[model samples]
Target: MMTIMRNTKLSTRTAAKEASHERIVCVAARAIRRSGYDGTGVADIMKEAGLTHGAFYAHFASREAMLAEAAGRACAEAAAAAADGVASVPPEQALTYMFHAYLSRENLEQVERGCPLAALASETARQTPEVRRVSTRYIKEMVDLVARQSPDWGQPGSHERALVSVATMVGTLLLARIADEPALSDSLRAAALQHLPVA
Candidate 1:
């Protein structure tokens, strides 16, 4: 009976530790998305997560370790969201759905919870080797997804179209974030969507 009770207590502790780790990742992801990679710090993430700085080391080896995991989580969430948008649409309409969803005003205003690549892509180019590699893989995955939805194009054109589409979406969102006027943000989205190839 004592052994059984001790095992139960250990299981509860393990479960609680796992839950705390998940919460840390969730809070870190949100902060990184809202404040860019370089802008966010370990202390801030821990404080925001209601965990202590020392406790962070218990969960992750370093800030970069957490960043890589957070980036992966963010990518997965974005991919799921994008997939949700395209799941019900026909293959031909996939581009329309993706482009429109990506360039939407709501997405633009919610960068903290939007596409991970677009949110910290510029900073990603300068990330640690592991982070850059993961970012590269994420980009390739997105391109493949777009290609799957665009079967009408030739091989070269398919790849080109995917690249162009992603580039346009990311570029437009970045520019929109920088522009001083709300109209300019709207114009950026309009121009990108208007110029994209449609089926």
Candidate 2:
């Protein structure tokens, strides 16, 4: 019985550590999107997660590792949200729904909760290989997701169109957020939405 109690205690401790690790990752993910890679600090993330800064190393080997995990988490959340956005729509309407939702004002304002690609594209370009790798993987996944929404998904030009579409979406969002004037920001999104081949 003593041995069983020790094992049970160990299991409980491990579970709690795993939970805390997940909490840190989740908080860092949002912070990166909201503040960019250079802006998000380990201390800020740990404090926001309700964990002590000293405990951060216990969860991650280094800040870069945490950033890589956070990037992955952010990208996964964006992809899942995109998938959920169109899940109930008719097949032909999926791409249109995605285009409009991505350019919506809500997405424009919610940097932390919105697409990481739009929020961190420029910053990710300068991050370490691990973070860039995670971003690149998700970008490819996003392109495929868009391509699948095309009626001619497997046909020629479909993949190319998806690439262009994704670029346009990301670029537009980036510019929209950068524009100081609210009118320009709104117009940028409107123009992109107007030109998007929302089938």
Candidate 3:
């Protein structure tokens, strides 16, 4: 009989390294959302992650590489957040929950914790090829996530509807964030929510 053996030392080291790497990525995720891709600095991300600047080399190749990974990570998190309360429900119900949640005042106020797509899409066109590629992949993934929540998913126009829906949601939130007056922000978000298919 063969028994599985645990390499405790190797496991411990691997776990620690992965924890540090994830800490860096999490910090980068929030930073990119709050500061835009161009505005975020590798040194600052490292500092915010509670590590020295020199320690970055162990986890990533370069700043662009880190940004690419961070963009992907941030987008993934935003998608998960958007899907949070609606995940196990029927498509119609999920769409209703998502439509309002994505356009909520709370989501608008929470920049660091909000959707990276809303925060970063405008700036993605100016990012490096690697970063653009990362953003593109996640954009498609997010669209797909929303598409799956539509009752017409797998139908011909489902993708287009999802794309439009996501565009409206992101655009509404973007305008809401930059609008100087609270009423304008509320109007933007409320209008978008009103136009939702379930609305």
Candidate 4:
């Protein structure tokens, strides 16, 4: 009976630790996106997660390890969200919907909660290989998602087209966000939307 009791206590402690770990990762994911990887700090993430600073090491081996996991989480969430949006519309309208939604002003202003690709693009090249690996994996998934949305998905040039589309969308969002003038931002988005292939 004593052994069983100890086992139960162990399980309970493990579960609680897992929950705290999840909370920290969740907070870190959003923080990395809202603030660049360099801008995000370990103490800030722990504080925001409502956990003590000292407890962070109990969950992750190092800051880069945590950042890698956070980057993966952020990418997965963004891909899932984009896939959900695509699934909600008719087959013929999926690409159009994606283009407009991605380039929308709301997405532009919501940098903290927006696409991590655009949010972190300026700093990604300098990130650790682990973080870059996570980013690269999701980038391919995103390109595939966009390509699959194309009517000529399996046909020649489809992948290329999707590549261009994703690149344009990301670039447009970056430029729009960089522009201080509201009119310039609006025009940049409008121009990108006009060029995007509409179904």
Task: List ranges where model 2 is wrong by over 4 Å.
Answer: none
User: Per model, how many backbone clashes are there?
Assistant: 0, 0, 0, 0
**Model 3 poorest 10 in a row by lDDT:** 1-10
Note the residue pairs that clash in candidate 3: none
Model 1 alpha-carbon drift over 4 Å, by segment: 153-156
- The candidate with the higher TM-score, 1 or 3, is 1
What is candidate 2's CA lDDT for residue 136? 92
lDDT of candidates 1 onward, in order: 0.85, 0.93, 0.84, 0.93
Q: Rank by lDDT, highest first.
A: 2, 4, 1, 3
- Model 1 lDDT per residue over 1-199, tens place: 9999999999999998898899888887777789999998998988988888889988998899999888888887888888888897887788898999889989988988998787897899888887887778888888877777886655768888888878888889888887989998899899999998776
Order of all candidates by TM-score, from best down to worst? 2, 4, 1, 3
Summarize candidate 4's per-residue lDDT along 1-199 as a digit string, tens digits: 9999999999999999999999999998999989899998999999999999999999999999999999998998889989999999999999999999999989998887778999999899999999999999988998999999999999999999999999999999999989999999999999999999764
Total backbone collisions, model 2: 0
Per-residue alpha-carbon lDDT of candidate 3 for residues 1-199, written as tens digits (9 for 90 to 100)? 1232356666888898899999999999899999998889988999999998998999998998899888888877877776676776665688888887878778888998888878886898988998888777777877887888877889998899889888898888898998999999999888888886652
